[model samples]
Target chain A: MRRITILGLTVLVTAAVLVAAPLLGLETIDPRQVAGGAGAGPEARIFWSLRVPRVMLGFLAGAALSVGGLTFQALFRNALATPYTLGVSSGAALGATLAIRLGAAFSLLGIPAVSLAAFAGALLAVALVYGLARARQGCSANIMLLAGVAVNFSFASLILLVHYTSDAAASFNILRWLMGRLDTVGPDEALRLLPLVAVGGFVALALHRELNLMSVDEELAVSRGVDVDRYRVILFVTTSVMVGGVVAACGPIGFVGMMVPHVCRLLIGPDHRWLGPMSLLAGGAFLVACDVLARLLAAPAELPVGVLTSLLGGPFFLWLLVGRRGAACSA
Target chain B: MDANRTLTPVLDLRHLRLELDGRSILDDVSLAVREGEHLAIVGPNGAGKTCLLKCVNRILRGWRGMISVNGVSIAAFSQRELGRLVAYVPQVGGRLTPFTARETVLMARYPHLTPFAAPGLRDQRYAEDALALTGIGALADRSLDTLSGGERQKVYLAAALAQDARLLLLDEPATFLDPRHRDDFRRVLRTVNRRKGVTVVEVTHDLNCAVLDADRIFALKDGRAAFCGPPEQFMVREVMHRVFDRAFLTVNHPTTGQPVILPEVGGP
Candidate 1:
């Protein structure tokens, strides 16, 4: 009953935000004009084409990041773990840098060349991490985590190398992309991301029970009949696809995945059934609201949503770490 | 002997050898447990008692020899199939977990539930029944992190019981229990073994508890069974002294006539 109430409240908030988000952007959107009557003017175009897609993109990217973050955290059994923590973002950055360096101008199947390149890069990083971890007997969480850290550092240097070789304009583009941005996505990009996030979210919800068991104890999970190794691989692959999609769409928005799941867990107990969907809804709402604040706070200037989120999430993460010493030690 | 004596043994392990990092963790050990029999294994800290239990459950796989469950080779059974046939209770030392006692117990139904299906009413009922059997039904809603050590141990036992498996492999089940809870655990074990006809293989450090509970006793020394027989046979002072490397005094229970042993304080 309490879980239902929490879920209901979260859905209500998400719905409210979804309706109100388009109204808060720089241009005033007349709802009557958007409702489609005579004299609709420029409001209809701005509402439909610009604000709606941007907000949709924000929600989609946030949901994907949070869901992927939750999955990775549960798999690794570490709260500090996130989709971006293991070089996915850096990989995407590298891919985007390559695209900029090559002067790529063509879009592939509706997705921009840069996003396509970023997605490919994210998948490559996941493959590299998975391969390195699997090469050692079992893909133990510790080994995978260490491998991810190593990949992250190597990818960072590779990004720097790409910057060194590329011209000044390409280097600036790469650095801006690395800071993470959530605006400027089109309806086509949002459409491309929707199906992937939907499938990934569905799979995650379906396996939430297994995640619950695995999080507590991996050996115990196996003894209770979870195909631990098989499930781990499935989860890793699923999270990679989801993270890749999000990064490709929004230049690797930071902290949504790491922050949202932990917040949702605190709200509803760690039952992933509740945590999974709740985190997604809360995450989408969170990013949209943050984007709104970023717009309002700077007015014409507009702070990057990623920058605002990181500013908030970094401290919350520290508080979480410091407040729960026991979890910190064990996790 | 009963009519079921003609049936296959519930558990059969033959020449099982496990080498970890080139060290012989288990060396050519063989044993069999009959249907519904309660067997207790007692040994020192490094006597491979836990390792042997792990072998039976296939948790630590890649053993050199064969393990059969009810006349079927373990290799033939999938992990889920084996899980339905056997439940394991590991020795957890009051670790804080994010699951409620009921939720933890319901996890036993994982092997029974189809992948992507939530636990149905039937599973919840069975979990509740197990909690009742362990006398922890009232505490089922409590988080495992908040439960007392004894209560937590009972929750683990309840979870194992909820599996409803034919065989149970317990490692130091009473390690965290107080005297009353220990008795409660023994009673629960008796109910499961006798009433439900479940086979049990328990690793315990408490010799007295074993004598009071188990139908048969298996003593291990350095990964090898030093003694395997009825509790009466295990009560022999010379065999007890030899297995534990200490002198022991034997006493029969006043009411049940079961043999109990106590190690002498000054024994070499």
Candidate 2:
């Protein structure tokens, strides 16, 4: 009952923020004027095109990343594990850099050329890790983790090499993209990402029980009727696609994945049934809150929401590590 | 040929061999267990007792042997089917998540639950019953990490009992218990065996506990079956000494007439 109450409160707060966030920009949006279409001018265009899309993008990206992060953490049984730990972010960055350097002009369907490249790159990286881990003694979590770390480092160095040789325009783009931002074209783009979040979120929540067992012990899970290998493969593919979409959409928003799940777990405990959906909801609200502060704090010049999240998350993460160490020592 | 057909053994393993990273863990081991029988596998450290149990639970794959449960090859059974037949209580616990004792025990219903379905009322009753059976009903709402060693041990046992499997595999279950808790555990095991007719296979280093509880004792030495018979045959000083590489003085318990081996030492 308490968990349900907490979830209800979180959802209420999230909905309130979702509605009020777009109105609190540099030019406050008057809902009455916009609703009746009487004063639907440049202010309306900015409200509909810029603020609404940006906030929705933030919410969807946050939700996808949080689900991805929670799944990865449970899959690896490591609290610090995140959605990008498997090199997807590095891969997306590399792809975006390559697109920038190549001066790609074609956009597939409605996705920007650079975002499409990024999505492709993230999938490629996951496929490589999966293949490498699967080829030798099955796709175990340890093998996947090690393979991902290796791939991440390799891609990181390659990205540096690209930055080293690229022109000033391309270099700036690469750096800006790597820093993470929620730059959306319009409401249509944000709406396009909703399906990915919805499907991925559903699949993740549905498998919460399996995640609960797997997090405890893989061998024990297997002994208790869980097909560990099959579940691991499904989780890998689901989280990869989810994280890939988020990275492509928002240029690898940092810390939303790691920080949100940790906070949710602390709030409701480690039962993934609650942890999964709560993290998704809380994560979306958190990013919206962060984006609001980002807009309000710097005023005309906007700080990247990702930067603020990292600044906040980094210290909390350190505090958590120190707190856990202290507890372990005392125990 | 006998007029009556022989009863099929509940468990049968033939010429089982397991090699891990170029090292032999179990070598040509074989055994058969009848229905409702309680068996104990005892040995020194590194004697492959746990390895044998792992093979039965199908945790360690790539073993060259035929393992049949009730005349059906274990290889043919899906992991879930195998789970319905066997419940394994590992020696060392995993990292404690924030699950209460009730929640932890309720996980034993995973095999019976449909995918994406929650545990039903029947499952909750089973979990509660298992907790009561293990005498940890009062601790059901407590977080598992907050429980003491003995309490945690009972929680694990309750979880396994809630599995409702026919075969129970325990690895050094009493390692963390005091004498009183150990007695309680033994009583619980006996009740489960007698009332539920569950076959039990325990790996332990305590021969006295084995002799007192098990109908048959299987002793392993260097990954081979050194002795497999009733406790009377296994009570021989030479058999005990050879398996453990130590001298033993045997005595019969006055009340139960069970054999007890005391290690021979020059002093103290």
Candidate 3:
């Protein structure tokens, strides 16, 4: 009951912030001018075309990736597991790099081309990990973790290889994309990506009870009528779709996926019914706050949201590890 | 008891074979536990006793065998159906967080509860009844992690009892308890078997406890049933020595007239 109330308040506060953000006079341009029939001057165009879309994308991507992380964490029973842990981010990066290399001819389909490629890449990465892990007897957690690490490193090296070989201007563009910037997206992109994120998140939330049983113990889960392989496959595909959608819109933003779920679990306990949705909301709120800070910290020249998340999350992660260490030793 | 009524076998294992890493853990084991029967599996460590228990409860799968409950093969039944028929209590260890004793018992009804629905009146009534039966009613609201070993064991037993299963498979249910608590647990088991007609299959190393309440005893040795019959068969020194690989002098108690095995000094 307390968890429900806390989550309810969180949702209300988030909705309020999303509603009140434009009214706060924090943005460089006026949202009213963009919405009204008044001509879209440079400020109105910037507000409508860039800032609004970017903030909305930030919210969607944050929620999608963090929810994906929560699913993976529950599926694998590992706190370190995330959307990026299985090489999906690197796969999406590779796809974007490939699209950029294709040049002006690919611009006809605009952002959809990159998103499609990213979806395919993320699916491919998951397939690879699944195949590797399934080859072992009974699908051990250690084997899955090893496969994830191997696939991530291989894809990351390929992405670096693509970066090094590309032309100077293309290299710069790819570098900026890799550094995780949301400035380039327009409203069209956010609308296009929202459905995939929403569908994936819904499917994940729908599997709450199954995920909760899985979280207890995998063997126990199987004994309780869960087809462990089938559930893992569904979770992998859904999380990949969500992560791919987010990575296609903005570059791979880490930390939100890895940290948000753990924090949500601590607050609401391990019941996935609460943990899953709470992580989604918390992720959005956290990223919005981070994005706001990113803009305000450097003013005109903004820092990458990824940099801020890492700077904050790295220490928090160490503290968590230390705490877990103390807990284990004491026990 | 009506002789005209057909009694359902709570657990039926036929030619069950379990192999792990090329070694047979349970080989061609077959047994039938009838309704209201209290069968105790007594064996040395690593004698496939726990493996047999796990197989019957469907915890460790991949065994080549026929395991049935109430004439339905385990493979044919859904896990929910199987769980409804059988409840397994593992050896107690570690703390399950956030779940109070009532909540833990409530988890036994997971198979019965509809998805996303809270426990109804029936479930609550059953939960209370189970707690009362296991003598953990006072600990219902207490966190399972905060309880003592014996108390936690009772909570776990209560959770299993709340499943309303006819077959209760317990692995070392009294290992963590003192002699008095152990006796209390045995008394509860006897009462539950007699009153509720719940079939109890327990694995224990304690010979005296098994001999006291068990209607039958099965002694396992090196992944095979060395001896299985009435309690009198297991009371023999030769049979005990063959199963346990230890020399023992059998003595008859003056008051109870039960045979007690004492370790033989300088005699094999």
Highest-TM-score candidate: 2
TM-score, structure 3 vs. true: 0.88
- Residue-level lDDT of model 1, residues B1-268, one tens digit each, is 5876637899998998888767888888899999999999998888889999888777787788889999899889888888899998889584578778999999888889987888999999999999999999899888888888889989989988888899999999897688999899999999999999999999998988887788999988998889999888888889888888889997777898766677777866
Q: Which residues of candidate 1, in runs, are more than 4 Å off?
A: A37-40, A101-107, A164-166, A323-331, B246-259, B265-267
Tens digits of per-residue lDDT for model 1 on A1-331? 5998999999999999989988787766767778873236677877777778888988988888889889888888888787777778878877888898888989977778998999999988878887888888667888888888898898889888888998888878877777677676348768888898888888888898889888887877777877777788788788788889889878878888888888788778888988899999998999999988888888888888889999999998898788965444333
List ranges where model 3 is wrong by over 4 Å.
A22-49, A97-114, A222-230, A323-331, B4-7, B94-98, B137-150, B176-184, B253-257, B266-268
> What docking grade does candidate 1 earn?
medium
TM-score of chain B of 2: 0.94
Candidate 2 residue spans exceeding 4 A from truth: A36-39, A135-140, A324-331, B1-6, B253-257, B266-268
* Order of quality (DockQ): 1, 2, 3
RMSD per candidate (Å) reads 2.7, 3.0, 3.4
Please identify which of the two predictions, 1 or 3, would achieve the higher TM-score against the true structure: 1
* Native-referenced Cα lDDT, model 1: 0.85
> Who wins the DockQ comparison?
1
As for DockQ, the candidate ahead, 2 or 3, is: 2
